[model samples]
Target: MDLHYSPFDFAIQKDPYPVYKRMREEAPVYRNEEDDFYALSRHADVVAALKDSERYSSKNGLRLEPAFWGPQAEQIFSFVALDPPRHTRLRALVQSAFTNKRVQALEPRIREIGKAHLEPLLSGDTFDLMHFAGGFPTDVISELVGVPEADRAKVRDLGMAIMYREPDGGPVKDLPPSAMAAVGALVGYYTELTIDRAKVRQDDLLSGLLDAAEGEDRLTPEEVVSILILLVGAGIETTMLLLGNAWHAAAAHPDQKALALGGRIEDWVEETLRYDPPSQTIARTTVADVEVHGTVIPAESRILLMTGAANHDPAVFENPDAFVLGRDTAGSLAFGYGRHHCLGAILGRLEARIALEALTAHIADYEIDEANAVRIGSSNNRGFASLPTSFTAR
Candidate 1:
């Protein structure tokens, strides 16, 4: 049997685990000449690649799609797409805005937002979990960024517009016209929002970013807008998907679901991250030739650190395929490593934990209508856009 893989293929995206298992066993350094990239499937290799930013650089952005890869990626990905010095400086400025005190401050508000969205759907009939999964995070992020209540829906719609892809339209090698338009609209919207906040100032993350400084250096207007856009992608979208993945994974395993709903929600979140991470693959560009498992990838080549595969690698995880809670998920790369590690990770986890806690408080048990569920099509993420569920109220 031949080994063939392409992240852009929708079929592969739907169920890449089987293929990932094969890649780990047969070709640890799997190559897809057609798509022009190499992949690392083992846990150690992916971790190594993520840590070795000098050789496996993030300068070209963390995605392989044509529109998102290259010098312009920074406009969308912010510090996530940059390497040291520049990455270090921008990350520090962004970090100041997300201080421990500030994130702890958002917990009460996050719980309120989660309950507001989840309470209305507790009637015990069939409802789509994605509604709460998507809306809760959107509202949380919008509130944190100080987007007015009136404009949050518009902002969420714009953020979601860029995530859709044609599942059967072959591999999406470039962003579609709709997605490109949405990107432009988001940039324009945030740019204006920054200008507005600059004048009137507010008690929000956007305001914090504006005030964040390193000695005498501070973020410029364009830089502030860039970080806001990054939040939409990193903070809201990924967190939304992570929650949905957790809901779906729990339903798939009744035993684990019982434990999760029985006050083990934190373990549920951790295991779900290790089992079915939302952000599956992270792309990087090679600055120098690298050899792994007897294969040499030349400099200037595109490479994918198969985060999803690494999480399931038998070497790192015991009984890697099972969806069991309470496992030590300390090494999971659901969030990457090194300097480019996801800045929104702490917030993402908090949102999921609170959202699920709210959910289990109202629902006694739930079952998924998997036949009608729809997974989002994207090269870098793996999660549902719609998860129809039936539950029993507590």
Candidate 2:
């Protein structure tokens, strides 16, 4: 009956598929006492829960922890955490920015940015990929969102703080006063930017959102600011993890590295996403009583969808543990499925592909400095906090 996993389990953090497999087979709808929540570990059950938003609402909040900033933060976070109707409306206002055409149009610019950032790092014999290569996408997204080049650093810092919480599932308390001050300053800066964009029309996504939201179901200024926050926070960190994971994969499999640098770079990116997703899990709350894999979940029970586990489910994928490039994992839930699927998935993929291509083309070889590299100690996200790698410039 006690099938809960501790968030601090280093072994599980490193490789959780085995434990997930056991959960899926033995207790797909197991409840944990530590977090006081139910979990859906199997591929089929997680997919059904994600798609059945009507039955599993997100209004209570997406995170495992309770909200601290009151209803405003709750409402803003609800964009991802809410069920349909309201979620559909809010999502529509900004969907254009992530359209296939728009992301395709940005591909060239993203490539250029990747090269520019990677070039400087290649000069050094060793560098932290998390800071240099992994961080480049943050600047790229910032620029695309109309953030001034000078303030990109501030945005990055705030994003890191917001996305990563402490091991106790609480807000980071160790941040210096200066860090909090920076967060306050950035929030005010974004507020002003939203106001400015509202007044003057521009060709950016913010302007487009302002124009589009003028009439029916119009988003308030606060909503716009919150959307911006979500966009930057989600966009930067996930992409950073993708890049770092790719480097880690390549270093582990020399053959895959050659294939990636050669003709199958994109496939490698997809495989990495499947093998080691940035978002390890997503949470949902049951709106009504539901039975998953014969286990009953009571109404209002929190359900954790282990995306990382589902991606490795043997029932859906053959040789799930192997990181085979170009494998047909059509049903892979790496991006999540159904309503709350990642809005920027295409853009994230393109960024990772371009970054990998540039690195493999310019660098001769690389190895992960496991001793120095730091794994981010969080349950929700799986990624390196600092990935130190030594590479030879080609």
Candidate 3:
């Protein structure tokens, strides 16, 4: 079957793997002339491209369009757009904060936050999982980044507004005034907050960023705001979608869900990430000519590393379509690989595991209303917008 991959297609959002499967087999290195980008679908291609920063340089902004790419995106997006030493330098400054020890230390607080949100929802028969999962991460991120409690609601609202991107190939800076205003609000909020945290010195990520002096390395004020926005935006939206996807996967495969409930919730988290990752595609621009599957992509070309497609590549797994418990999902591109691997992988895993365990503990089994469920669509991300579920009290 010939494949047409449109990120905005709601039909594609409904069930993208079949299309992805065809892309992997038929057109591993597919080029969409209309969209004017090259897609690398197969597991091997995607993995190689992600690690080959020299050839498929991320320096030209991660998105397709120049309006949101290049210099404009660099201003706000920080290191995701850079390559090698620059990317390495900026990453090193903040990498210590997300170390395994640090993420482990935050487990108790993650449980507390998870319980506080889920407790209220158990009172009702039906509730929106996204709504419940959304704020928990934002709250945790807010506390970590020193976002004041009083302003978290507004911050989250602004974050949601900034998160929405038009499907059209336009620059985000050219987005609607409301969206632009929300960006402005986030910039202003963080600019002031960065300055405040520098002086007060709280035990938060922002404060650590202020004083994290590894020899001569340190972050500029503007750089701090940029990274904070990147972390806050990526941290909240992706994990929020992940929590919903976990339930979406469980509802679709009852047997796997049942097996997961038998004290193996972490496997469900891993499988959910493999099946419907919160991030479907990670975009990049070629710094030089690169060849994949006998196709030569010219330098300055836009490339879409289809992490979603690669996750289900049949060559790498036994049954890519079906959800099974405890499969060997090694080399999973869900958190990505290479120089730009996800910084929050551990943190995201911790949060999702806690959320799922708590949900299963509360209601041994829950039915997801798939007919009413909505999928989150974006040029760069994928997952559910809302996953409503009902369960009898245990």
Question: lDDT of each prediction vs. the true structure?
Answer: 0.89, 0.74, 0.80
The digit string of per-residue lDDT tens for model 2 on 284-375 reads 77778998767788897877888888898888989988888889968778788987888888888888888877877877777889878777
- Worst lDDT 10-window in candidate 3: 166-175
Q: TM-score of each candidate?
A: 0.98, 0.91, 0.94
Q: Write the per-residue lDDT of candidate 1 for residues 1-394, one digit (tens) a residue.
A: 7778998888888889999999999999999999999999999999999999889999999889888999999999888888988989999999999776788799999999988898887765778999998889889989899998998889989988887656557777888899899989989988888889999888899999999999999999988888888887788888888989999998889999999999898899899999999998899999999989988999999999999999999898999999989998888999888777787888888898898889888888989998899888888988998899988888
Candidate 3 residues lying further than 4 Å off, grouped into runs, are 65-67, 165-176
Candidate 1 vs candidate 2, TM-score winner: 1
Give each prediction's root-mean-square deviation over alpha carbons: 1.2, 3.0, 2.4
Candidate 2 ranges with C-alpha deviation above 4 Å? 1-4, 8-11, 68-78, 165-185
Task: Report RMSD for candidate 1.
Answer: 1.2
